[model samples]
Each structure stands twice: as structure tokens, then as C-alpha cells.
Target: MGRKSWFWGILLCGLIIGSAASGKASDFRGNRWGGSMKQVAQQERAELEFRDDQSLFYRTRVAGLNCYLIYQFDRNQLYQAGYIIPPRNRNLNGCFQDYQKLLRYLVADYGEPQENQALWSDNALRDQPEKYGMAVSLGHLARQAIWYTPGTVIRLRLWGENRQINLGAGFFRRTQEETHPHSKTVFFGI
Candidate 1:
């Protein structure tokens, strides 16, 4: 081939490879974000904890807490994965400690969150930081942290309702709707 043809050949090949790599759905573990549900089932590190029409939960441990690993699917294609520290027979103090431990783990792996919130609905216990957990259990406070990655958004939430504590992390994809003028996607900021 002529010198000009040789350079064009290499450039075309490079463009083809780059486009294929960028076509991947999203960044996550177990399998590609658009992979089959069976692909994730094969990689489970623990027993199945729960399941429904569109989600799977596996019992696992993270950050020293017994938790449930979550796998969510759309039309049987894996789209999201996360963890939830399950409910247990523990006090408010213990519950909040678990949240803190899990929070630190995410920060270590993904850096500081873009937004961190500890919202209070009542101030009766506001001055008592030591009893913040109690405030949470009483439905007076809720906490959440958010971090954004190249193609994913990570959220860590700790809240209470009906005197019950809840904690979990969710990984969701940020779609091209971010730039597509006609897309239906909406990103509600923290």
C-alpha cells in the first residue's frame, strides 16, 4: 500500500476499536450493565436473600456489616448493583454506627461525595449530636451522600420511618439524556 493508504488504514482500525469499547452500556461489576440476569446469578458470592419481578438480593457482608447485595434488572438485563445493611435487633446507636462504617467504605473507594445531607424535620434533638441516631430512629433526621462517576451515579442513604432504620447504596446509570435535547431523562440534584 502507498504511505497515505497505510496511515488511513491504521486510523480507520483505531476508530473502529474505540467505537466498540464506547458502546458498552455502563461501568459495574459481575457483568456488563446490559448483560443477562443469568450472568450475575453465576457470580453470586452468597446465597440469595430475596427476589421480585425485577430485582435480586443476596446475603453478603460489607464494611463489617451483614448486608444484602442487590442486583436489579430491566427486561432481564442487569442494570444496577448495590448493598443494603439489613435490619436487625439492635439499638439506634448500633444502627448509626453501621451507617458510618458503610459510608466510610464508599468514600474510600469513590472519594468524597458531591453532596452530603443530614436533614432534620424537627429540632428538639438538634443540639444533641451524640443522640443523632436516636433522632434518626425517631423519624426526625435522614442522611444521604451522592457521588458521580463517568457513567454511574452512586448514592448512600440512611433514614428512618415508623421507628425503623434503613440503610443502602444504589448505583444508577447516567444516560445520554444528559445531552440529548429530546430525551425524557431528568436528573434531580441532591
Candidate 2:
């Protein structure tokens, strides 16, 4: 009985390990759901900083023709972030007041389409600054606000992961008065 139990335990452990071993590497992409439908979650942006002087930046992304929402906040030279997605996008907008409900929630806010190139931008001097750190992948998202002296530099990132492929997207934000440099980086999977 002891030997049998040990064998069973070993089998279970092997099965678990085998399943995990099939997952994609950090930069590797893969197919999912037997090719019926593939999905990738958003990723987080890489760590970045500002230059000697720069300010106020913005960026955006869409989910393969779908929109994503982002919320940004500033406090005493510090920056914060929030996210929202609308119910309509979640297939839950069935009620007569769905629009109103969505407006209230902003859980899945529809923003712009996904960025095709490695970088994106809203300000002229910087479009996903090349010197700043940035990383975004499917299924997750991250942002950084660098407070250099009295100015503010904001970095935004979004990523998602599914059985199929990995995806990453991001942008940056800075204020006009702020004088901090910015950096940029890219992910390859998505």
C-alpha cells in the first residue's frame, strides 16, 4: 500500500509538471484552443524614468478592434492610476439602462485601437520615448510615475496572456512644466 501511494503521488506530480512545462517562455508565442480562437492578456510596461526635463505624456491601445480604458490621477507631484471596462463590452449590457450602467461602471471603457508599432505617443517630442523603460504583455498591465524634483513623468503599460499568444501594449504621460527625460522599450510576442 505504501509503494502504491508513492507511485500515485509521483504520477500526479509528473502530470502537474508536464502541464506547466508546456507554457510559453517570456518572449515565446504559442497557439491556443486548437486554433478555434486565440486570446492574449495585456502585459505591464517596463520600468522607465524621465530625462533632464520633460512633462505630460499619454498613450493608448485597442484589443484587436476592441477598446480599453485607463484612468490616471496626480497628487502632489505623484501620480496614480485606475482602470475601467464597460458592461457592453463584457456581453452584460442587456438592461434598458445598460448605457447608463456602463457609464457608471467604466469597468471596460472603450479607448483607441491597439498600437501596431513598438511604440506609441500623444505629445510631439515623445512617442513612447526611446530612452524610457516600457513593458506590457497580455492579461496584465502596469504603469510608473517618475517624480523628478518638481515635475512628473507617467509611464503606462497593458498586457494580457491566454492559451494562445502573449500581448503587450503601453504609452507615456508628462506635464508641460515638468522637465524630466523619458525612455522606451518594446515587447515582441504581441
lDDT of 2: 0.22
Against the hidden reference, what TM-scores do the models get?
0.73, 0.18
Off by over 4 Å in 2: 1-64, 76-164, 174-190
Model 1 global lDDT (CA atoms, 0 to 1): 0.63
RMSD (Cα, Å) for all candidates, in order, is 16.1, 21.8
Q: Where is model 1 more than 4 Å wrong at Cα?
A: 1-26, 176-190
Give a tens-digit lDDT track for model 2, residues 29-126. 22221111112112333122111121111133233222222211222121222121211222111221322332222223323222212333323323
Q: Return the number of clashes found in candidate 1.
A: 0
